[model samples]
Target: MENKQINIGIIGCGRIAQTRHIPEYASNKNANILGYFDFNKQRAEEIAKKYGGKVYESVEAMLADNDIDAVSVCVTNSAHASISIQALNAGKNVLCEKPMATSLEDSEAMVWAAKKNHKLLMIDQNQRFAKTHIRAKELLEKNTIGKALTFKSTFGHGGPETWSVDGGPNTWFFDKNKSKYGAIFDLGVHKIDLVQYLLNSAVNNVSARLTTLDKKDSTGKLIGVDDNAISIYELDNGVIGTVTSSWTYYGEEDNSTIVYGSEGIMKIYDDPTYSIVVIKKNGEKILYDIDQIQTNDNQTKSGVMDEFIDSLIEKRVPKSDAESVINSMRAVFASIESNETGKRVSISGTK
Candidate 1:
């Protein structure tokens, strides 16, 4: 907030930091990378070497730096809430990677921390900024899609080991203690957030099946976390649908989402050839050529970090602020419950 420039620090110099956060923040005039911190100091040092930031010896040291104004929490899923909460209580704005946390309670605590410190706590749900998805939401809101009914979404890619920094089968992404769940928590949340965003709905219940059908660790053993998940959700508005996430697509990555309504069926990311497609109830087809959706594999621009900085400077809450984060967190935890109990679990979309 000093001179409209926010000094930024990064907690986890892993793949996402390099692939998304560090580069994206570097391109913005208002956000400055003050330093980096990682359990592996060498990794942090390496990022600072190329990106122009000092390396912190520990999270405590980084948090104690009064010069730093904000921090990006891009560690594994499990560390998101803890780091973000610490940053917020340290009086620094926080832009945390998605899934909010492994559980709803952690996410709630994170929100509480943000409120207690009067600092920004934003979850980086960047798919909402995808041109196709943005256009899809506009159409839905304008009734270009009429009364929404149901939807189905799928997000998949080759396993994370390939992209994780110095990765192997033993990367933190596959560890249950570090990642919580594989494709479910990692990729599934992205698709689910887009679904709720476009539909303007909140999940009321979820039934899910999560599995590790094929992924294995270096010892050729199945990792404790899941590799695939399929969930059926019923939203408060009576819209019902299925969501799928997997680390075994083994083909071109699939991050497609389809929404159904009385007037039309809207499709997004369904075709590598098209950004969006819609078929009206009367059988008329419409197509939109917009920016392609960003994938971890793609370097297309992401507006998440920039948006966070802008919001902080303008004294406004970011688009992916705490309330939206908690709702998405509710949906995620419900799916986890459904998977564990093999029963449809209820989600309370209330405070």
Candidate 2:
């Protein structure tokens, strides 16, 4: 018998869906967008009309659909747990956006729901799917950079107020309650998860300094959320890493990673279409242009969406499963704890 395409429901009709997730999933042959739901009914209707899908009046209605095999949650940070839990309890798989939840308790509940329902629960840590980061992971595994010694990775841009096409100062990103953290939560989660993925190692301890540098919101009013952050981490392998994330950087796109090891050095950057440059101890340098390496432009596709589709069709597990993302969340929570206590917090010994 031929396999039927898996039907998916989108829980949020926000920027992420319109920009990345929606386009990627719509292009995949193995997946079909069954419907979409948003708190703003108009937005959901608009996306559904434009994309040729149905609109559900509520998440409950979407969850009750027998055709919907999975739900991609693009909701704000605060709603991740509740929406995901409902979807899972309704016997549907989940593809949730990053920073999993606002607090460890919420994140734990989401994971519990997935496990209880025996459905796939994936976190959209798309940075792991980036061509640059993938190449770096391969090089690390190959020891092309030797035994990893220390690492530094960063992702930053001007505040999100100007990032969206609408240019509203009222983005969910500016809401500390909705976003959970600041730039660190919005952008830092990607790099932090990437560090864990590339090294395949756990972070043991972290000391963080979080600050709200640009106190003004999009409307130029004082905002309480942090705008800049610096965090130092000790990896389980004894390698140390320092991550600096900010929404106030005025220069170029600051997403890069530097890896130093006993045998060589490796660097990945995106100034151009993602590339990896490696320097060996023997004084030879190898440059990999990821765009050229990734035939069929696989690098440009939505890795999370593609993987989710593959997992559905192949009946296999995606590497970026809920448990793995939860580990990254542990680090994020640790940083917040450290920031509040003004001392280093150790994740290794925590529950």
Candidate 3:
């Protein structure tokens, strides 16, 4: 029921926790953020103090505390499976960040671990929660974009340096061992996931060309990870799409997705605002601006976290749960394979 507050714990007090999770959880009255755990004890303490919560030394300690109803694994890309699996086995529901895992085996294990423990496993693919994205998805489903033809989506920002509070080599975003596939995995995951989410389909095949173009560290040294990447995919629904993700953009935050259907075209962008533009076959264009739907802070779909809390209490599937995000992971891994082999990779058995 929505009458009681659910106890929540966060593992990995990194950029995600500091910016999104902490603020969102603190503002939501339905969830009680009991505390957080980070490898960096000082960072954990800082976040907990700021949120009126406590810091636990380890995930086990946090999970052992009976008050924690759920645990958010905000750790690195590689550790998502292990941390979430450990939390699930400990009888705590888990909400892990994107990419599920860097590889298929780990991703599947994370899913299986949740099933084995009968715990909820959610992937924090919050792009679908964006008002613009949700509105576009609705319009597509309503055939407002006509018989889905093809789509192009891209997410480009000025690298993770500006995005993270603590910049430089210290940031795990630059660690290949932790981050997996640079921009392709970091930013591409959202685009791939949103495509599947909006189309209600799985990528049937994928091909990619990856590059570490313009790689430069804080000191201007060459970095090992990729700075720009592109992937082409064919959805099971027969819709072909292209997804480009980069950490090399120099100006303006650009996250835009456009879909062209037999009847018209639909576009959604993040720069100007969270809004959707649809053009009908008759050449009539309609723009549904979500400026008013935005919260006082201009954060769109700030209610998604609340929705997750409500789903937990209602014993229902959360929007960002594994059942959906697994498809995104499939697309990511398949794209990686395509890049490595310089050929199209078929995503067989993917729904």
Top TM-score model: 1
1-351 per-residue lDDT for model 2 (tens digits): 039898999998887777778889899888899999988889888888888889998999999899899999998888889899999999999999987898888888888898888898999988788767777898899898889999898877777776543345777777777877888888888888889889888888999988887748667886677888889988888889988888887655577878889998887783365378888999898888774222211335657899998987787888688888877788888988999999999885432
Q: What is the TM-score of each candidate against the true structure?
A: 0.97, 0.93, 0.93
**Better by lDDT, candidate 3 or 2:** 2
Model 3 residue 270 lDDT score: 38
Ten-residue region with minimum lDDT total, candidate 3: 292-301
Superposed on all Cα atoms, the candidates' RMSDs to the truth, in angstroms, are 1.3, 3.0, 2.5
Q: Give per-residue CA lDDT, model 1, range 113-187, as digits (tens).
A: 999999998898989888788888998888877898888899999888888886889998899898878898889
- Which residue pairs clash in candidate 3? none
Deviation in Å, model 2, residue 346 alpha carbon: 0.5
Q: Rank the candidates by TM-score, best first.
A: 1, 3, 2
lDDT digits (tens) for residues 199-297 of candidate 3:
998998999988988757667776777788899999989999899999887765568888999999887873364368788889898877764333212
lDDT preference between candidates 1 and 3, better one: 1
